[model samples]
Target: MPVPTTRDKNPASILIEADKCSGCGLCVNVCKDFGLEIVNNKVHQSDKALFGCIACGHCMMVCPTDVIAIEGRTLSPVLMFELPEKSQAADYESLLAMFKRRRSIREFKNKAVEKEKIEKILEAAQTAPMGIPPSDVHVLVLENKKQVRLFAEDFSNYLKGLRWMSSRWFLALIRPFLKKENNEMMHDFVKPLFDVYVDDMDKGNNWINYDAPLAMYFYGSPYADPADPIIAATYAMLAGESLGLGTCMLGAVHPFIQNGKKASAFRERWGIKYPSREGLVVIFGYPAVHYQKGVKRTFAHIHRVS
Candidate 1:
């Protein structure tokens, strides 16, 4: 059986150069799917594979000899590159410092983000794990403040039609079905958000995306794990910070741009491919405001259970 993903339905084809095989069993040992084995002093495809070759390419990546190659399912030898030296990677302390320095910046300078920075942000985001091979995450890049504002305005207009969802009667109707926290969130948070995002936009204030210089919408297909786009968005946000660009994740857009014919039409206008269960939009630019101090944050709970 092959692992199903949005990109491909079939398992990757493994090509073994039996004549070049050293019978070292290196590929066999590393094949977590049990897709390879050595028999009669030659490496061969195994019959007892757990899920055939899902094409993680671990066997090819670890092989000392270039005897195994994976083809199809978005796997290619050309995609391989030399790993960066461990010493060149960010240390824990430096990474922690970067994390601490980052603040959710909404107000931004009018200057545009450089194209090179945008490209590098995408490059780093591509390295994020997607819970599956050949990540299904797709990104829509709005490269300038004008484009971002346009999208924000369009989204605000869209939200105008959805205002009824935040009405008192609607909240009262749904309160009994939702958890206490969700009910409170819908009432105290989301309702006011609806007012500000739409009404402010009507008054020529772009509260939706804050008119940032750059924006990226990371989303996934139906077959994608819901966390895929969220993880990619986080990576992009961190990449923006590393590139000296302020960043903020806009949560209101994705949920609204899903379901119903109107939402589908809006997505089509913006070139979005599919309705993802989870998605995020991150706006980037030079920050208008700077913080002198870092805020300490903690998780609600941390547990270690035996």
Candidate 2:
């Protein structure tokens, strides 16, 4: 027979016999070169991996039955198992430009976010690098506006109950200033966007949470030595941004949920018990107002060591 043209070396040809394949679809997912596809519930060749497969063998390894085989002609292609195309990624200057352009969004649209889009964002949260293995971080998805209102009332009362634990004079002294002061601190810790949101709610209307059609609460065990919900929440927030959704972190709400009565009711209704670890709440929705652009930044100096 003539020299097999398949002998050209990158990923030359993939010989897959369907009869031997269990139709696991693992190969379809593992092939990074866009070299495989599943049709009629079976896997088949989609593209020649000659320039693509990189000969990493991910497909062959994950294959349970050892049916798939990859043939190569030349040097193997580089595998991207650790990170995504960092070699081709932008330089430090370019990244600083992107960070400078980042902005905090306020004012969400009246539109409802699609369930599938929410699911995609959550998938990124699931993929976040965990500090330890086998940690259970729970997500509570609230899509109903009515329920959001209920939670807000419950949340407000929860704060009130905590206030009740103090002296009456102290409560009286702080009552008038609580909303004003809480709003300001909220603006500082969470986001400046909450300044407007809290103002609207103070006007006897549950406006902010009302505006957000979606919210997710994340929680983990409190018994752990170091609670890392905030770290995980940070991942979820970035993941949400990557998926083209607007997110505002609500650091203030965790206190109410963990210790307040209104919070207890909300938790009981949802059948969520306190994790012996850490917890967080993340709110997301389409922005009613697009951020015009990122604001100016404060300067920081970096020290480099040779």
Q: Give all TM-scores, in the order shown.
A: 0.95, 0.55
Which candidate leads the pack in lDDT?
A: 1
Tell me model 2's lDDT, rounded to 2 decimals: 0.60
| C-alpha RMSD between model 1 and the true structure | 1.5
Candidate 1 lDDT over residue span 124-231, tens digit each: 999998676878999999999889989988888888888999999999999889999999999998999999998888899988888999999999999898999999
Please report, in order, the local distance difference test score of every candidate based on alpha carbons: 0.92, 0.60
Task: Give the C-alpha miss distance for residue 242 in model 2, angstroms.
Answer: 2.3
Which stretches of candidate 1 lie above 4 Å from their native place?
none
Worst 10 residues of 1 by lDDT: 127-136
Which regions of candidate 2 fall more than 4 Å away from where they truly are?
A: 1-101, 165-168, 171-203, 207-210, 224-227, 260-263, 275-278, 296-306
**What lDDT tens digits, residue by residue, belong to model 2 across residues 1-306?**
112222232235566777777887998887766778887777788855434554446676677776667666432223213455878876989666645544444456776778787877777676654433233456777775566666766555444445433434654565576787774554354343343335445565664455466777777654322344566666777666656667777655655456545666767777566633456667776666665666665669778899
